[model samples]
Target: LLVLGVPPAFALGTNKFAASCASFTSSLTFIKYRVYDGDLLKYLVFGTLLGAILGVKTVLLLDSSQLRIIIIILMMFVAIYTLFVKNIGNENKFEGVNKKTIAIGFIVSIVLGFYDGFFGPGTGSFYIFLFLTLLNYDFKISAGNGKILNFVSNITSLIMFALHGKILYSIAIPMALAMILGARLGTKLAIKNGARLIRPILISVTLLYAVKMIFDITNH
Candidate 1:
């Protein structure tokens, strides 16, 4: 949006709003189909709420240049690690949710949820990665649980942006509707391709975003 002359703040807020709306809707489907673990989602909400509050303040405090640089550095690391680490999300070895697992989930939920409110470019990707590494969930289940956590963090962040009067309803509402429609197709394809689809998409998007961040830095 900035490339096309949309105000940067408005773009960020609108995108966050639309994505939150879409994520909320898609999360319901995941719950309906039993793709997500209800037990884990409980702690995710708590961690995400606290993290989102901190994140909203962080983004509001930092200048765009500083924020972009931080985001680029973090995303670059994620992209590299994901590419080099092979066969990480291949299997589901979920040893039933325990206090240990929930503890780690809380830490990461705060971190990733902070990321969501601060920028939100790779919220889902990070959630999926964290769940896979932390809980030993396969691509399918990780993606499902990721949606649930992402939705909560997104809503939390959206409320913050809304409170600040940043949301652009004209842009957000339409994008949200389109995103909801696309969610149907996205879920269907996930079912059809399974890990084959999720793994590559995650890696590819992470890398592409990293590259884009580099470009953004250089251009700016």
Candidate 2:
């Protein structure tokens, strides 16, 4: 009955569904490691599924333009920080995760997972930033861990959309393969180059994507 509560007009049509699935699959290509790790993956899967249910309901009522604006602003902030801030001697800043950081991670995970389910663009970037800044994870490690969480969120969202008949399998299958390939390449790069390399790529991608979103918002 929850599905029925959503207006039929808001249901994802064939084209939009296909686009979303393709986008999801394409995103998977950038990570180098396995998508999930032990219990954390399991928890992320559960969390993402739960978040998706709520996200679908909320997203249908949200203003896409406004969301785009918010995302662009976030990207700008990340770009500024990356460009000006120095990571020089702070390598040991996040050597260990503390209780507060864990709490923050959980909260951010849920919130970001909801957003990912609702509308994904810079989900991976957000995950990486949260880990690096708040949790003190170095760039490469954060990217590795981000992939795990991102994969869980993507899979869960995909499942939810599939159940609701909002996914286009034809697009999803091929796109997923592409994403997996991209993820492998991205992961390898991150591992080989370490934090120094990952930082620049992250900044570049975030800013470029943000600019694209801003253009989209303005054009619409």
Candidate 3:
């Protein structure tokens, strides 16, 4: 949409609108398969709700260039770390949410949700990483849980976008239909392929997005 001449705000709003619809369907799929971790969701959803609300408000006040740079740095760290850790997300070690995991979940979820609302890229990658490292989940479970959190944040932000009249309904509706089909298929594949499929895709997408952000920052 950006390349197709949509304004940045409207592109983001429309993308969020479409993604929110897709993520809702994806979340339901994950839940039906029982692939997601329910123990951590309560905390993650709560933190994401608050953080997304705060983030949308903050984006109105602050220049996001600085935040982009910071996110780039964090993305690089996550990518590099995941690349070296071969067995990181291969197995599920999450026994159940405890005090320590709960604290970590709230902290990471709030920060990532804020990033999602403010900048709107690589949010799923961040969530997957946290679920793997902090919450002890496998790639399939991580992706499943990540979608749920992503949906919460996306919907929260989408509401803000709609209220501001930034979304293009015609474009968003068609794209949303496509996204639903794509997201459902992707979720099924992720469940079937597990870590082998998810790890490389996650790494590749994060690196590509980082590079794109770098180019965008330099050009701007």
Candidate 4:
């Protein structure tokens, strides 16, 4: 959408809002299949809601150049670490959510959700990583609950976008229909294949988004 000459904020906002319905659908599927962790979700969803509410104000105040730079730096690290590190996110390991994990989830969910609302790219991937490392969840479970939290943030932020009249329905509607099908396929694969499917895709998308953002920065 950005490549199509849409303004950055509108493009991001419209995409997030459009895809939100699909995300919600995916989250429900994850929950219906009994793979989702409701206990973990309580912490994540609460934090994301608060963070997303603040995120609208934060992004509206920040300069676009600064926002791009922050996203670039963050994704640069995510790409490098995930791509280079072998055996990370490769297997399903179960460690119950401890105090440390709960604390970290509370922290990162806010930070990540703020980013989700303020700047949308890579939000899902960020959630996956945060869950794997902090919440002691395996890759598949991370993805399941991540979709739910992502949807919550999206809903909170979408309301703000709608109130401000920032969404382009013509663009958003078509994109949304496509997203619903895509999200359904993605959730199915995540449930069946787990980390093997998610790892490479996550790394690739993160790298691609990072590189594109850097390119946009230089051109600007």
Tell me the tens digit of each residue's lDDT in model 4 across 25-64.
7988899887777876686778898898788777766744
lDDT of 3 by residue, 1-220 (tens): 7768887677878999999999999999999999898877877798998888787777656655577787788788888988999999999888688898888889988988888878778999999998999888899999998999999999999998889888999999999999999999988888889999999988988899899999988876
Candidate 4 ranges beyond 4 A from true positions: 2-5, 91-94
Report the C-alpha displacement of residue 197, candidate 2, in angstroms.
1.8
> By summed lDDT, which 10 consecutive residues of candidate 2 come out lowest?
7-16
* Deviation of model 3 at 176, angstroms: 1.6
What tens-digit string does per-residue lDDT give for candidate 1 at 34-105?
Answer: 887788778778888888778877887775546666766666676676677787777888888789888888
Listed in order, each prediction's TM-score against the native is 0.91, 0.76, 0.93, 0.90
Overall local distance difference test of candidate 3: 0.87
Candidate 4 weakest lDDT stretch, 10 residues = 89-98
Name the candidate that leads on TM-score.
3
lDDT of each: 0.81, 0.61, 0.87, 0.80
Which residue runs does candidate 2 get wrong by more than 4 Å? Answer: 1-49, 61-63, 88-92, 95-97
**Model 4 Cα displacement at 127 (Å)?**
0.8
Q: Which scores better on lDDT, 1 or 4?
A: 1
